[model samples]
Target: MAEEHEDPGVSLVTVDGIEGKLARVELPDGTLEDWRLASLPQGVKEGDVIRIDVRGGDVDVDHQETDRRHALGQRTLDGLNAQTPEGDLDL
Candidate 1:
């Protein structure tokens, strides 16, 4: 399980996906949680990393974290792609 944020009431959650009015999120402990799509920040979509200030009752997108994670994922994908041979494969 992942440890909670240093601050008692602050933590991070990832928006795994959205369906209609609800969104499925992954908690810090890797458990699934459902939240209202309207309750989240405007323009939020799948794969967005959000910062929740539970004590302050504030929920907002953590843009830096999201971008960082995206970049890391892209690098991983690029590395994997580089490992493949550069020729067409026989059926």
Candidate 2:
């Protein structure tokens, strides 16, 4: 019989990109891996940093980082929108 063990350490990661239903994340150690977005918490988006509890495989958002990234993204979108004409904006 094989013995099962749980990991005791948590991993900090950031959302790098999304391909279809998979979310590519960058680990604290700088390794990249893909996980199912459906398996992660709600409202996760690119550039959002999160903490993963290894034992339970639970993910929690780093609110501060998430907010910062959200603001940055909004600013970027605003800039793009400004460059775009009123009727030419795509959604």
Candidate 3:
């Protein structure tokens, strides 16, 4: 029986960070992969969502998806911080 999993031909990853020529990406499985900056889209920055075509080795920035994910993250943060409060304590 084939195990259930996402499509292997395509993947969506977020730009985690960039180090020199290497770009760090967070995969859907929460694993990190290092890709050459040259392989990514021009002007790629942290938090940018990328769509990778594994078979064709094509990578592109998904602006719409990025915005969606960003909004989702902001909503999550806002929801989590809405209730429980804590005062800032300077150390």
Best by TM-score: 1
Runs off by more than 4 Å, candidate 2 = 1-8, 67-91
- Residues 1-91 of candidate 1 have per-residue lDDT tens digits of 2235677789888899999999998888899889999989999998898899987999999898888877987777777777779843322
Which residue ranges in model 3 land beyond 4 Å of their true spot? Answer: 1-7, 86-91
Per-residue CA lDDT of model 2 for 27-63, tens digit only, reads 6667788999997778888887787777787788878
Candidate 2: 10-residue stretch with minimal lDDT: 1-10
In candidate 1, list every pair of residues with a backbone clash: none
* Whole-model lDDT values for every prediction: 0.83, 0.74, 0.80
The candidate scoring highest on lDDT is 1
Give residue 55's error in model 2 in angstroms. 3.9
Q: Candidate 3: TM-score? A: 0.75
On TM-score, the stronger of 1 and 3 is 1
Error of 2 at 9 (Å): 2.7
lDDT of 2 at 8: 42
Which ranges of candidate 1 are over 4 A from the true structure?
Answer: 1-4, 86-91
What is candidate 3's lDDT per residue for 1-91, written digit by digit as tens?
0111277788888899999999998877888889899989999999998888889988899898888878987777677666556733222
Better of 2 and 3 by lDDT: 3
Q: RMSD per prediction, one decimal?
A: 4.0, 9.6, 5.3
Going through the candidates in the order shown, the clash numbers are: 0, 0, 0
